[model samples]
Target chain A: MHSDTKAPLALKLSAIGGLIFLLAPIALIFLYAFTTEEKSYQFPPPGLTLKWIGVTMGRDDVWQALGLSLKVAAIATVLAMVLGTLTAAAVARSRFFGREAISLLVILPIALPGIITGISLRSAFALLDIPFSTWTIVLGHTTFCIVVVYNNAVARFRRTSGSLIDAAMDLGADGVQTFRLVILPNIGTALMAGGMLAFALSFDEVIVTTFTAGNQSTLPIWMLEELVRPRQRPVTNVVAMAVVLVTVLPILAAYYLTRDGAETAGSEK
Target chain B: MTSPAIFAPRSGVLARAADWAIRHPRMFVFLMVLPIVLWLGIVYIGALIALLMQSFFSIDEFSGVVQHEFTLKTYAELLRPSNFAIIARTVAMAAAVTLASAVLAFPMAYFAARYARGKWKALFYIGVMLPLWSSYLVKVYAWKLVLAKEGILTWIFAQLHLSWLLDAVLAIPVVGGNSLSVSYLGTFIVFVYIWLPYMIIPVQAALERVPAPLLEAASDLGATPKQSFRMVLLPLALPGIVAGSIFTFSLTLGDYIIPQIVGSGRLFIGQAVYTQQGTAGNIPLAAAFTVVPIVIMGVYLWGARKMGAFDAL
Candidate 1:
């Protein structure tokens, strides 16, 4: 807080450099999407064109993948919100045995490697003979998405005054009425923020989806396949630009919704 | 006013049930927790255990069918020199990326937490998070293009007449190669770029918590700024650094896509698992390979919990 305690010039420069390093690759994604060269990545593109946008729009496969991705993300987010809120209420609002272990169990899916989750789910599905469909992808996604929503909801639950619930009950309100009239309003924004964050995460998820989605191709899976086969390269980049915008909006919205709260959804304590 | 008791008997069944639920808190808690426990505990953790069990089963070398009997043969196969190399290479790269991210993230996190104010602070925060919100695959592909033989880096080096420098660097032992796109250095760089934000946020969060008075007291007690930073700031921020490393390290260790797109066509644990299961039809070996990251993270998380890293998380 003192002038003498200010960060040095070198430190400031390093910070700026770090930001640039973080952003430059993303900038390249936007830049290459408009490149005239369709197949090859020529450094200084001989020219720039918007033809790739038209090409991307014309592809039915892209549209199909996009539609599937939206469906999966939406369903997964809904499941995450319900189950995550319930878990949060139970863990944060009540004292019980095995609470810490339950908390750890909830967080494990996201904390561990995605590949581990993927393979385990794959093997489990095989073992149970559960057919891989859109629902399977949703099920795989709910595991981690629940962690996101749980973190946000639990933090909000802990922060809300316990006396408010007690007072509602003393005044003859039942549990459902207390929850609907008192608790929901308190945690609505936190739940919405968590759901949005979860949706964003599920939308871009590839690793787990790869293991769970047997035949269905989500947008990222399509992109991965397109990358391997190479048909109209710039078109794939254009679709990537679309993916960026789609995912970024929810994340930014979640940020604004939770900005006043003590904790953000993803960076939970 | 009408007496409220008049409405009590008239209440719907749902309201009565709610009242009953309120009276039985333990039952309510159990009901609330059942779905998640079923999903995360029974389904997810159960799957992990099943996978681990698969790892212990032996795979018939001839028919490639999993025998399902308990045996360490699948794990013993992992000890073969080629398979062991993949594990060693992946761990080394994960360590290198974690170290690099922590070093790079610290100064930026320090500046944002200590020096930046108001609008500048918000901008720094968004700058770090925006990239994370974007497509992970796109960023990795962008690096793939950037590090390609005829890509931007080569062009820039050529413009500066430093192409020979890049060539010489690429000529070094295991890490060096013909081009950045197919070399170990390229994989390491892209891995760091992707996971940098995960490291920055926790470090910034940790640094923001260091009480201003602690630093002031150190300086007021006649300690130099450098000495204060070394003694006070670093110790306090260690947990945050450890927290960030957990994300960076585990993410890198589990990633198959990045190495597939950018690195030399060498096997890493993720790739090995993917290929073994998907192509070779060797579920036992794939399950065994997945355990490498699981075990590593188990130990890493235990150490992190000891350091109170979850507080910063």
Candidate 2:
């Protein structure tokens, strides 16, 4: 807070430059979505139009891919919420052998490279005769999705006072009643935040999905295909704009919900 | 009336089970954790083990089918000069990206942690996080457009009458080419842009923990600002830097999409593994190649854990 401790003008200027570097490409994506050019990227488009939005909306394939991505993310978020809540309850509320190991195990899915998870899941499915379907994609997604929920829930659970449960028990409430009335309300926002973040993560995932989705194209996979093999490129940019909207909103919501909670988690250290 | 019903036994089996579980905390914990352990352990870890095992089994060169018998032949093949070059290139790129992100991120992280306050702080954080929220593929592809022959970078260089600057840089060996879009430099720039936020957040977190008194104390003790930053701030922030690098390095190391789209068709570990397993049908080699990043990250994470990096994450 001291004036003497403040950053120099040059440092602030460079930070502004860094922000521009980060955002310029995203800004370009939005700009080009309205460009009239369909074949190649023109620095200064000759014309701008809103017609690509209409075209993108009319495409059945885009709808199918978007629907599949939403379904997969929803299912994966539900799975992560249940399993991750249980994990947080156990690790945060009770002492156990191998607890740290379990935490590490939970984080491993996301901590290791996505390609490793993709390759492993791909082979494991083949070995077990599990066909690559939407279900397969869900399972693959749930692996990393669990980590996000676990991190959030565990932090909130730790911040929750154990004495609340004891107080409820002393007041003649049963376990279910204590959980339903006391514990649930305390961690509800945390779980909601975790679920939203998990959903966002699952929605944009491409690498693992590439391996686990046999013939299926999630929104990201479709976007990748569209980029690699060009066809009416502006249409893909329009779809990208939609994706940015869908994913960014949930992430912002999660940030607001968790911003206060983060201090208690001591993750800032 | 409610007290009378409270003592009554629940009619459903599930309700009785809930009653039993609440009374027995240990068993409750066990029951609560069993499904997750089974899912993560049997399914996820089991898959990883299976993949590792596949690496040991050899592929028949003639039939292009993976054999059940164990062999070290695949590992030996991975040591070939071309394969080694790919490994070296990927690691070098990862290191370079990590360094670039850290250097670029530190000043911003410092400014946010120490100088900015209240709404300014919140705006800075939002700026850092906004890019992370956007689609990763879209960002990479956007960079593709920006670096294309007739894209924004070229347009700017042409306007500046310095078009030959980029051309001269592109004229160099392996890492360069005819245009920015097809060069390793382009891929490096995009990688740094994508992962910069990861570095900034952790570094900011670490800097936030450094007390104002500590810096003031250093100044009081006759340390120059630069000296105090080098001696005090850098050491304090080392764990966070390591934590951030863990994300950037591993993410870059295993990414195939950026290289596939932006580079000059140079093979990274991810692309090689994808091609080997998907196209060539050589499962063993792919598995063997996959082991490289796993081993590298295993060591990196172990070191990071020693530095107390997980707490920051």
Candidate 3:
């Protein structure tokens, strides 16, 4: 009993330490955002100011880059969800030859290093004479985004009782009707969770985007450029905060959904 | 009903085509896989061929044109001591970050999988993944603030009366002063933090698959808690640890953005490729640079498969 008690306490302390490690960098950003320093190396800012926020909000370039990023992410997420759901359904529902091979192809983009994907996409675009554009960026993102949606949907499909579909069909329901009333209801949460994850992945994706995006800059790319140029640290912070909030909210929603599912699964077993 | 009334020959052609599609499901499968294959072949393979060819040929300085003379000039240049040093440094950095991410992520994964329940578990998992959702640029920017001399960390040190420790660490002769200011260390720290979620999620998924009954059985026997963990849990979770490490290692190795933003253009393979393509205008050399990493990664993947790390991911 004493040993068990000691172990949990030790684990908890280690967990808290991990949390601090995660938050320290974030907290540092928040602190610097309010600083009064001109350069970045000062130990302590002499004062604090809200000037950086205004500067960030006023910058047109930052807005342009952010808008481009949003546009790419939105388009990519929708495409991935649709294709991923279709592919998942086809694979999970119908037994077919070469199924594993097809699944492997779908998972490859995410499993392989992003650099390989980027280079591959870049070469294909060049071959098709598809000029580097926002479309190319979307293509690259959707490739990997599909993997997340597929994983979630497949898991949901596996857990869902096959009898429910059969019973609905037996009750004089047509294929579409059975799908609408039975299938959709069961997988609704899964799909929503998958979509959230896909969106999050698309939002943060940079490696492939860098290669596919010919000249246009995403918010991340813009921040990278600014880092090298060195005049826009505060504005960068503002945009960073915006990104943190946007990405985090949806992920929280997705987590709650998945957790509910996991608990039910645990209880069922 | 109209088939008979329609042209008999045309009907036969339609039937044959339908028969062909059904007969060769491989064809359908091939078509379905075509997009990605074409993507890989045309873009990936094509560019790689172009790059490989470029590496062999030398560039003419008289008119600044790439001349198609088959030679090992670029490889020779890349093999030089200074360039080799850069590769060595990058590998070391990548190895360190992978180790750091694994150590940091293991406990988090363990806690979420073994202890947390219901909504709290979900919330904690989401918190770990939330950083992944944010823009990569924003996160890197946040790190810059954290590590900057005038950043929050410095301020916190002063507030806590720990500035002496900070100064002492920063001022330690050859090991500290110049190196701390260079930003590579800051970049390494941020990379580990930013990629932590990726490492954690897969490991958690793997660890979660370990049956609770097995652990109980071990404990119920003569084995102590530590012994049970060491003997059973660690062996089962080994696949996940390996899977997560590959992500951390490869990501750190290939990433140009974090290093570019945080490492201040200190050359990494990714940055080297970007520079060769964009700044130096040496497309061939850049392509060669890109191939170096791919070859290395290919070898790594093969090794990973041999070790059975592929199963977990």
Q: Pick the candidate with the highest TM-score.
A: 2
Evaluated with DockQ, which candidate comes out highest?
1
Output the TM-score of candidate 1. 0.91
lDDT of 2 at A139: 92
Count clashing residue pairs per candidate: 0, 0, 7
User: Could you tell me the TM-score of candidate 3?
Assistant: 0.78
Better of 1 and 3 by TM-score: 1
**Chain B structural similarity (TM-score) per candidate:** 0.88, 0.90, 0.83
- Candidate 2 chain A has its poorest 10 consecutive residues by lDDT at A260-269
Q: For candidate 3, lDDT tens digit of each residue in A1-269?
A: 01122237777677767777765655556666676775553545677888988888888998999899889889988888877776676677666666776677677677655765776677678777999989999988988888888888888888888889879867855555666789899998888878867776776777788889988998777867777687766666566666666765655565556554534211100
Q: Model 1 interface RMSD, in angstroms? A: 2.8
The interface root-mean-square deviations, each candidate in sequence, come to 2.8, 2.9, 6.1
Looking at model 3, the pairs that clash are A40-B150, A41-B149, A41-B150, A42-B150, A120-B44, A123-B43, A124-B43
Candidate 1: segments with Cα more than 4 A from true spot: A1-7, A95-98, A248-269, B1-13, B211-229
Per-residue lDDT, model 3, residue A103, is 76
lDDT of each: 0.86, 0.86, 0.71
The alpha-carbon deviation from the true structure for residue B200 of candidate 3, after best TM-score superposition, in angstroms, is: 2.9
lDDT of 2 by residue, B1-313 (tens): 3446547777677778878887787888888889888878887799898888888999888887789998999999899999988899999999999999999998888888888877766668667777877889988888988998878889999899998888889988877887888898988999999889889989988888888888889999999989998999899888889999998999899999988888888899999999988889887888899899989988988989999987776
> Among all windows of ten consecutive residues in candidate 1 chain B, which has the lowest summed lDDT?
B2-11
